[model samples]
Target: MKNQNIKVRKHYLLKMAFLALPFTFAACDTEDMLNPVPETSISDKNAFDTPERIIGQVNGLYDAMKDGQYYGGRIVVYNEIRGEEWINRLTNGVTGLQTWQQNVQSGTNEVQNLWGAAYAAINRINVFLQGLEDNKAKIDPTLYTQYQAEAKFLRAVAYHSLVTLYAKPYNADNGASPGLPLRLQAETTTANNDLARSTVAKVYEQILKDLNDAEAGLPLTYGSAVLNTTRAHKNTAIAMKTRVYLHMGNYAKVVSEAQKIVSGTTSFTAPTGVAHALQADVALPFTNYTTTESVFSMPMSDLDAPGTQNQLGYYFNAAPVGNGEYYLNAAGIVNDAQWPATDARKVNFIVTASGNKYLKKFSKPSPFTDYVPVIRYSEVLLNYAEAAARTNDMPKAIALVSAVRKRSDAAYVFPATSFATQQALVDAILKERRIELLGEGFRAMDITRTLQTFPEKTGSGLNAPAVAPSSTDYVWPMPNSELATNKAL
Candidate 1:
């Protein structure tokens, strides 16, 4: 076990001109928070002279979020492997992610980094919002409002990621469990770090508020397809809201929010200015960055690769190109007869060799640089379908699920009389979610929210011999390093 102090400072701000430059400023790198400050630290007040300068700060927010520890890889892979969807291939020099498979203590690097990186990004979003509010007079009203909304979206995203891991599921006794330390303010040196943890209810309230604000202020499109996918947009926040509400067991709200994105159509077509819809080819989203389906994909390029060890390929692609750190859960999806054999996803996504199944969805070559999908329209439709089932809208549920299901396996679309009961339709929706979002990072959260027990309790590498239905092991403890310093916890 190791300790990491997530010291959040504003020195890492890139100049507005640097945003136009090359790879140098593409990825955000974090220095040890406890380390000596760089002499180049900019005063928060002066960091942005022009409104354009703030864009650099906003861009850097995504980079911090794209921290291989979070959206980059571990954040997605850790959650997926924890459930039965994948068997962690631990023999290939297992260190970083093996701890996740083992379900290590709070001090483990995987959990620590996930905590540290999210807070670091959250802190940056705070300062960015604070700076914008303080300097609103100097900036264009339109740009100022947009960035404010964007910062809140990023902040809500960071907090949501943090709480999902560090605390119980949002519906845990209806969010009565202790959530994260609500660090909403921009921390200066004088501000006390000893803030108390908020209840899951309060944390969710804040998350919804941020998302609602973000949705109201964001536009349908930004500068480019790349920028539109990377940054927060109206649909991005709406897509996120569906996930949040779905987790909270607010099925009506989930259907309500998701409908804003999917509209009345069962399939999600990119509306007017939006370039998002389900990619006709299942693998196109990961391989070609943005597709009609990408609601919010954290952007990665040659200029901004997620780096060597932290790259997603190191964990997923195994055949001839990758180290093959993890493989698909055979009983779950790899060879399941229920999953149509001719399913395009099965043919294109499930990669197998020597009886082991590795997923190719994250298959960017070494120096892995696959643009991580944060929230795709596919998930939005699934969310809508799940909510529809819960609300007893049988036709909508069956139709929505079938619409998404047919994209990957046209031969397997449900018949008109299929799914006789709500439970049956919900079951189909749950299976679709796990298969459709395999490497895209929605498995463990789905498992927890649905009150299902983790299936990989017994495994070779890092799994506990016997995990029961009520084990606290599913909930990550607050990191020891932070507790030592923050008395309020």
Candidate 2:
């Protein structure tokens, strides 16, 4: 049965390609290029029979994942814009930095690129799911199950990214917090033109459903290290769950999910064999050539391609002196300390000169480097600490946080003898997360979610920048293209 389904899907794909040629050919007027288009679609009735093709398609998804437009481009920009680490005045040739800070509505390439890349991923996943369903008979049962799970995971991830940037936070009371238009089908027709925005709650529910299925269906690990590094797995799904729960202000669930990983209840173990805490040699932590601290990372190579680059290196390193573009404040902020004196992480990764600190997270010299980590074990540890603190498990929270600080050679951990309240603990945790996860595409979402969870923390006078629940800036506006086409939005 599975075999027959594969044959059918292959035939359908071929037919679709043949139908698309007219459009492809029409666009090429005087195309006497090196390569000519073939008249007929390639046949692969047995293409689905091999794990190679399935894996290849999955790899293609990763390629799309790392596109400069999506995580590869705008994600880093988004992170920089939201954090105190960057000042808008220093941003040159950075398209959206001004609009982002002023909270203005503007259409720019960065916004369009991010939107397009996300939809491209969603479209691929939709097509893959559709193909699997069409050819379920020819597919091995286990293979089909795994493929489906992968598709769901990708879909969930795409939606989560979209919602975080383009829609309002879930409000149980209002039920109308603007959300992105949901596109679940592989093919679109005029009949589906009037798609409306799903409430934040609805989108979150879908995200949870997809992740739950992914967690259940994906393998404990993949056979190839490339696959292990590039693709989604059970542990990644588990980690994502912790993220989702945290965003939703479900502290108990965050604690539950993070604890499962931290406690080593299953195959989802912390980076062992080597210490999993921050290193005195800060550079050693980032050198991660043979470590498993990176639970999920996008694979890149020096080879020029659409989705491969050492993004961290390109943005943070000093451009002339090193390769970085932005300079950090060497004297440090009015309230914050400079990068620790003897900590190797700071010494190796940060360049200090003329009262400015430049980033060295990506030690590579060129824009191209292999692999960019999206999530790491260190993040999981912090998530566990934050969640535990929220649930009044201060002792465990302090221990986890202190362990991370000790590794960095910091003086002390949070919830210090002077700080006694939950709010105080939350503030300390937020500060730790900012310092630890700086330039990692988390600050904006953290600020948004925190505002939702604690409306009073929203703070201040009328002109003080609409903080969280009080303002609409919490969610970014949908791309103009989406709004024009999807009336429901």
Candidate 3:
């Protein structure tokens, strides 16, 4: 069954490839790839008349989301380049340690690939939403709402990620902060090429609105076993809200959302009949796709699949069978020791050999496995801790932190003398996040957002040497292709 899904995904990718070429050639300038369609010819009379058709269209959006160009490849590349983990393999011979801080004029494939892929997903989501609306009455109203909510969530997520990486952080005091171009409709013609950037706050407002609508419409849980882990549920919506709130520095909202999941008081329930817990046998959580820990994951299958497979382990692990892109060294291991020795979460998740520690989060030997997680349960606990500490609920914060720590048999108690203030506690939580969530495509966002909240770092080691926005190193420049086409940057 999983193999069938892989084949379907490959077929969808082929269709997208063929569909994208005309647009790709038409634009000439790659940056115009994300322009919104002023008018879509797709009408409500013909789409979603059958269950099979609607399902296929929805599946296409998921396939686009998993494209190596998007989450599978360049998105991870952007995350790694900005973070402390694996340095650019191409820059190894270069002298400067700050090679990642290069200007957008560098025109690296990594940058172009990321920009193109994000727009591609946005385009796909736009098409799906248009189809669903056109055939609203022809489809089951419940399924129609669910599919629309899902596409909206995906679109909002893609846009949010693009704005964060492509533009500056949102400043409430400054209404002029540049944000990514807002592309809400599906473009099918050449006239939609002209586009302009929106403000950061405006972009975030759209993201929040989509999430709110999705939470209200999505089911508490998926009805089918095959769909539960693979599809977004009410809890997934809540989990994403927690993350978005955290980035926005809304501690009260973060705490409210996270606590709902952490205590199992809300719509979220651990996958029934799955007794999966944080395993004590290994240092890191196993990359098992069926685990209860996953809030949502893209399902992959087939050892010879066509699309991007689970190559995270293959790329990061030490030599022999693995590609030695960023082999762990002594310094890497020492920096990673932030994970306590007794924490089994650290052992199985990271491979320590030859004095280097390789990330083993997705250790499956097969090359063709689906591997993208938008959110996970472990992140929920961390969110609760950070938000509680920020809100002056030290006891609640410590308890949440300890719940995760105790799972791995690591030290669950924080000394009362360790942090005298809420700010200090927040620092500890951030450090824990860096080590725990490394290589999961979050370090860069965390770094940028943290610097925004705590400008002063006299005591907090996390911010002692901060990366400033004005510094070329803080943000990746607009891709040269994008700059050339839009000319707005």
Candidate 4:
């Protein structure tokens, strides 16, 4: 958004920086990707001079991604608030009041911050990729390919997140609508800042290309559980493809990509690559972030947190556990008769305080350090099930949906009438998504991708009117920072 490069200053390429470094690079403001000061920064010239420095650069890419403004927290909070499930309890301007009310403008702080953070991470990836190639002879060929694939995967993630929020849905007019500026090359200076927006289709093409290359080059499985959960691997790329394809309304492609790792219809387990499958308890992944079910997550620690007022726990949990900025909407899926109170999801993740219900998925106390899930195996199964149902694979769809649902509600069974018609079965699967993925940030994406209106939300003296697909507010506007800095908008 700043039309500038993302540069790291002192101590960024530390050997022990595994997750994030908002503290160590406080002077450099590493999280502010749009405004990097080169005068006192560590030049990319020596970034890859040694193997340790190269590995640090790889970790740096992830640090950019987990900035509080991006995946570390706000992205999840914004997506959930923009949907119908959550109610504004505080109406705090710094938080997502405008977004939850569907009145966000180009100048909105959240809008500009998210846009800048995403591009900041993207520029860092580009810079890393170019440096890796320039210094290929110094590094092992296998490590070079692996690092390149990791950069590409991260780039794909950043681009996809930006497109979903700032551009029209891929399903909208088949992605013919205008998209964000596709900044692929490294931006070490302000010279290359005036690129025009590409079509949504073109942007998606690049995203898919990056993901394909990432899948081919990334390892099948990292040696450790933490690495498998936090880093991009072959299954991570494939799982991301299912999400991307589903967004484009490419059900066939979703199934095709999903089938590579999803081995069985009934059990629904990944046949290879870390042996991903549904955890016996839906709460296990939240408590134990490195569980096999967690395909990809951004890890946090006491030392490196998502920052004050930015953690998911701060927004959702009631006082004592969180700031209680927003509470669950009583009229939302929480009250759905289909999602029984006995369900494991309800029992483990929900809590009531002073007659108000709150989502406790990210329930970590102050300086919330809960890992944020990027994608999970259950979601993969659900995505595959949706694609299968849309493509007339009724049995496969039924089996997959049942697996996800029964995992949380083992005694529950799908009513015979729920599968009587294709529409009925599809509707059932959609509801399951709402129930299963509730506060995990799928609501806005699911609603928009399918061209459904944002359902009206009312409670806690706050009201957000339903936003139809035809409305300008359905998708966020390009940030004012971008308009101010980039000549092309």
Q: Give the least accurate 10-residue stretch of model 3, judged by summed lDDT.
A: 454-463
- Residue 40 error, candidate 3, Å: 12
lDDT score, candidate 2, position 194? 51
**Candidate that beats the other on lDDT, 1 or 3, i.e. the better one:** 1
Candidate 3 lDDT tens digits, 1-489: 657645643443343334432221222334333553233222223345577767777777776766665665446545644555553332432211232433343366556556667777887787678767777877789999998988887777788788777766653333257777787886544345447888877888888898888877778776654565677777777778888888787889998876566654212234432222333433333455545676766666664232432245445655554544453333332255445665665665667655556666655554635356566677777887898898899878776666666666555455565466887788777777766666667867877766542122221112123456666545656665555444454
Query: Whose lDDT is greatest here?
Result: 4
* Stretches of candidate 1 exceeding 4 Å from the true structure: 1-42, 91-102, 264-266, 270-275, 413-418, 457-466
Candidate 1 residue 231 Cα shift, in angstroms, is: 1.1
- Determine which window of 10 residues in candidate 2 has minimal summed lDDT: 455-464
lDDT agreement of model 1 with the native: 0.74
TM-score of each: 0.89, 0.80, 0.80, 0.92
Candidate 4 stretches with Cα past 4 Å from truth are 1-42
- For residues 207-288, write the lDDT of model 4, one tens digit per residue: 9999999999999999899999999999999999999999999999999999998987568778888899999989999999
TM-score between model 3 and native:
0.80
